[model samples]
Target: MPAAALKPKPLPTQSTAKRPVQLDLPYAPVAKRPLPAGRPREWYVTHNRRLKAMRLAIALLDSGVYVPNQARNETIRSTARRIGVHPPSDTTCHMVRALMRYTR
Candidate 1:
């Protein structure tokens, strides 16, 4: 058989990203946001609300699949990305970690 005839057809292009077969990384980087001091109570409250929304979204992710299997950190990151922000507050991550721990 000729080599050219034996070659397989090229595959179609993909719109969705392919999951990597493997990943290597050191510890995940902590996300930090510095809110200015001397702000009003309303600012604080709104900040809390936004962070709570983020937490709720994470909690709701994968229909509440247990954290470790849900790839919780990545899930949180993508949720934040979709909202066009990093994790809103230090407490947000801390709260998520605590919730995951309690759930497990």
Candidate 2:
């Protein structure tokens, strides 16, 4: 077979028409309220297990009725479970500590 025969034929082109482009009208800006200081917007937006644990911890601390038992890990796990969050782990404890630090 010849090289010319092996080459593919060019595709046919359709006629192009010029049409008017419509631009969207700009709307007026609305005033927005600012988020509270020291707390992150992500904390409210994302409901991750760790954040839930942290929120629970903060609420317990603020209530002034939460007392730690001999087993700290057990207490954390029980509190998390009561609040419908994931079982407490090292990461959850770390998140609670970080949240405590920020609030202080």
Candidate 3:
């Protein structure tokens, strides 16, 4: 066979189908409680404390003031004490470990 005859024919191009149009709906007011009122005062206090501990841990890690190691529990507890967060929770300690890992 001739070289030209050996060439394969190209496949036909696919036609695109029209997509359905989406309609925008007007915003509706949701029956939700106000932010502060939604949560108890103690809840907010605990959340703030956790946030403070996490921020302090990250700052200490960045400043080379606290080094996170395999003994993370001790590191977290000591860091919390140094930063004046007494009796850091397990959640706060875990957050410290996460932050340390993230920075690395």
Report the number of clashing residue pairs per model.
0, 0, 0
Comparing 1 with 3 on TM-score, the higher-scoring candidate is 3
lDDT of 3 by residue, 59-99 (tens): 56655754456526766677667767776677777777666
Off by over 4 Å in 2: 1-50, 62-71
lDDT per residue, candidate 1, 14-102, as tens digits?
A: 44336433435658868987888999989998777556654645544545545644545656656667656655455565555555556
Highest lDDT scorer = 3
Question: How do the residues 1-104 of candidate 2 rate in per-residue lDDT, one tens digit apiece?
Answer: 99999999764334332454454676886796665567676775544655565666765576452443322566666666766776766766656655655655
Give each model's whole-structure lDDT. 0.60, 0.60, 0.66
- Error of model 3, residue 4, in angstroms: 56
Q: Which candidate leads in TM-score? A: 3
**How many clashes would you count in candidate 1?**
0
Candidate 1 lDDT for residue 29: 62
